[model samples]
Target chain A: DAGVTQSPTHLIKTRGQHVTLRCSPISGHKSVSWYQQVLGQGPQFIFQYYEKEERGRGNFPDRFSARQFPNYSSELNVNALLLGDSALYLCASSLAGGRRNEQFFGPGTRLTVL
Target chain B: GESVGLHLPTLSVQEGDNSIINCAYSNSASDYFIWYKQESGKGPQFIIDIRSNMDKRQGQRVTVLLNKTVKHLSLQIAATQPGDSAVYFCAETWSNDYKLSFGAGTTVTVRA
Candidate 1:
């Protein structure tokens, strides 16, 4: 089976612009989560959706939002992007929402804010 | 505030040698601990995980040891190989929570 997959592996945006990244979870997975990874740092959780419902959210600002589809695919959107928003956006999928399930990650979309 | 942190920023080891990486977490309520390996330009891969009920867990050639008393966690790789070179991160989360808190990763470099 294929792992989690993401689209537009690379993106470049300008300050004050908006960008959207997409993720397709593994087959039979029900939960999808988004994380932002800065250079030299670990991934920071952004949002988690289970069964198409928002189950968790991280410390990110209002500019960041995400939603999951019925098929378990997810989209992460960033509005009014800032230079600080430049990072790799990762998507992970799991069988469920809680800690009992191990998450499988995607290759991630590298967002560069110019 | 709960947080997870690593003891070292980097570790260099020779091939066929053993490697150890350490992490410390401040959340005593966290019952699940996981280790992830991330290569450049890719997402993290699950290495191993342990629950608070157990002190140790092993997977393939890797081992994860947990010490709840000191809130410490360690990952040990036996006969490390060059393919093991990557940034390793330790994450913690409670059974009731949906989020996983990650620490600053430890970069492992295996030399041939």
Candidate 2:
């Protein structure tokens, strides 16, 4: 079975620019979540979408947003990016939402903001 | 275990030796815990999970122990190998919010 897949493995952008990262969830998986991992840090949750609807959100600012499609693929959008946003953007998919959710993660897209 | 240095904590262990990495959680209400291993430029891979109901869970050569009385968690690997080298993170999940709060992570380097 194919694992979670993310697109645009790497990207570079300047401050105040916009970037969108894409993710395709595994087959038969309906829940998708986004996380940001800086160097030497753990993955920080951003947004979680289930059945094309957002189920939960983390402590990120308003500049970060995401949506899930009917096909279970998702996209993460960052507006007016900052250098601090330079990190590995990871996409994870689980069988369902709610408690005790075990997620399978993608390789992650490395985002560089200059 | 774990330390609060600017960099991730590093634990070097020789191959064929046993390894133990520890984590202290802040919340007492956390009922579920999970350990993940992340390699170079890769996302975390789930190692094992244990609930508060039990003090330990074993999978293959890996074992996870939880001490609710002290809010401590540890991962023990028997006969450690070079492939076990990675950043290990412990996460806690509460019943209220399904979000998993991750630790800073401990780097385990299995020396040959």
Q: Identify the leading candidate in terms of lDDT.
A: 1
Off by over 4 Å in 2: B1-8
Model 1 C-alpha lDDT per residue in residues B1-112, reported as the tens digit of each score:
1112458999988899888898998799999999999998889999999999999999999989999999999999989999999999999999678888999999999999
**Docking model 2 quality class:** medium
lDDT of 2 by residue, B1-112 (tens): 2223232388888889888888988899999999999999788899999999999999999889898998999888889999999999998988887577889998999888
DockQ values of all predictions? 0.79, 0.69
Name the 10 consecutive residues with the lowest summed lDDT in model 1 chain B: B1-10
Candidate 2, residue B22: how far the Cα is off, in Å: 0.5
Q: Kindly report which residue stretches of model 1 are placed more than 4 angstroms away from their true locations once superposed.
A: B1-6
After best superposition, candidate 2 residue B36: deviation in angstroms?
0.3
TM-score of chain A of 2: 0.97
Interface RMSD per candidate (angstroms): 0.7, 1.1
Kept native contacts, as fractions per model, are 0.86, 0.56
Q: Give me the displacement of residue A2 in model 2, in angstroms.
A: 0.7
Query: Which number leads on TM-score?
Result: 1
- lDDT tens digits by residue: candidate 1, A1-114: 899999999999999999999999999999999999998998999999999999999999999999999898999999999999999999999999876799999999999999
lDDT of 2 by residue, A3-113 (tens): 999989999999999999999988999999899999878888898888998888999999999999889899999999999999999999998976477899899999999
